[model samples]
Target: MTYQESHFFIWIAAAYLLGSVPTGLLLGKLYGIDVRRQGSGNIGATNLYRTVGRKVGVMTLVGDCLKGIAPVLLARQFGLSGEQIAWIGLAAFCGHVFSIFLKFKGGKGVATALGVFLALSPLAVLVALILFVLLMLKWRYVSLGSVCAAAVMPLAVALLSGGRTLTLVTFLIGLIVIVRHLENIRRLLAGTENKFKA
Candidate 1:
């Protein structure tokens, strides 16, 4: 293919690599515990909080968010268009959801999804953040907050981002987050889901 095609492939590869960093796993290993084997058996921030402590959980949260933001920023630096940038953002989200090193078992993709949305549509992020805070305040449940945030993400993006490609990308991202949280929803309905502790 042409040079542009090759460059696009390279950028996507880079984005995937960024997404595959496994921040939770790395932090868990540092603390001498396999995060996947502990607590809820999830390598996400919630599990980190239950298995380890708030410090490590916050670290995982920041790292996961950065993985999403970094690659999209790099793609922009490469001078990719809005449409072309969507691919890289999607790759980053996919990497977080299906990390190669995690045996394909990954987090709920909420944090990573936020990273991409933050890069592509800042206003959408602000709107989702407000909704997330309000929902979590009322329910005191992270999973419910995450589910509501994901559900609102698409509408937020559609309203904040007028382009079809960006809107579609945001919709898919939100869908993925919601689908990943299916178990959480079930637990919420059953009143068995764990809540965030101070």
Candidate 2:
């Protein structure tokens, strides 16, 4: 590969590694627990809150969100093109979805994707966040709310930014988030999905 390609891959790898930090898992350990072994068995903030405490949950959320933001921002600072920035964001989201440190297991990519979108298309992310909050408040189901927001994110990005690259990245992130929620989907269908306990 040429030097440019190598540099591109390096940034992508860095982004993936940043996303693979397992913020929730590490936070759980600080409290002497394994987040992946408790509650919904997810390493995301919701599971952390349910298994640990609100503070730890919020901390993990911030850490994970930063994981998403840092990589894309750093790539942008490096003068990468918009397409490269989008790819880096997607790589970070993929890393959160399939963490190397977790033996290729990881959390659903909602929060991390949100962070990426925050950099790529702030207004679209804002709309999606509002939708998420409204859905959660109306239905008391975090998973449902996340899924709904994710469902709308691709169109939001497309319409708001008119950036095909970012829109494609958003669609992929949303698809991955939905796939990661397969068990939750089944539970929802059976009317057995756990409502947000907050």
- Which candidate gets the maximum TM-score versus the true structure? 2
CA lDDT, candidate 2, residue 89: 97
lDDT (C-alpha) at residue 153 in model 1: 82
Model 1, 1-198: lDDT tens per residue?
999999889888888878887899899999899988898788888899888999999889989998888888888887898887987898888888889877776888888888898999999899999989998888789988888888888888888787888888888888889899888899999999887777
Error of 1 at 163 (Å): 1.1
Clash totals, every prediction: 0, 0
lDDT of 2 at 34: 95
Q: Which stretches of candidate 2 lie over 4 Å from their true place?
A: none
Q: On residues 1-77, what C-alpha lDDT tens digit does candidate 2 reach at each position?
A: 99999999999999999898899999899899998789989999999988898999999888889889989998999
Q: How far out, in Å, is residue 84 in model 1?
A: 1.4
* Candidate 2 lDDT score relative to the true structure: 0.90
- Judging by lDDT against the true structure, name the best candidate: 2
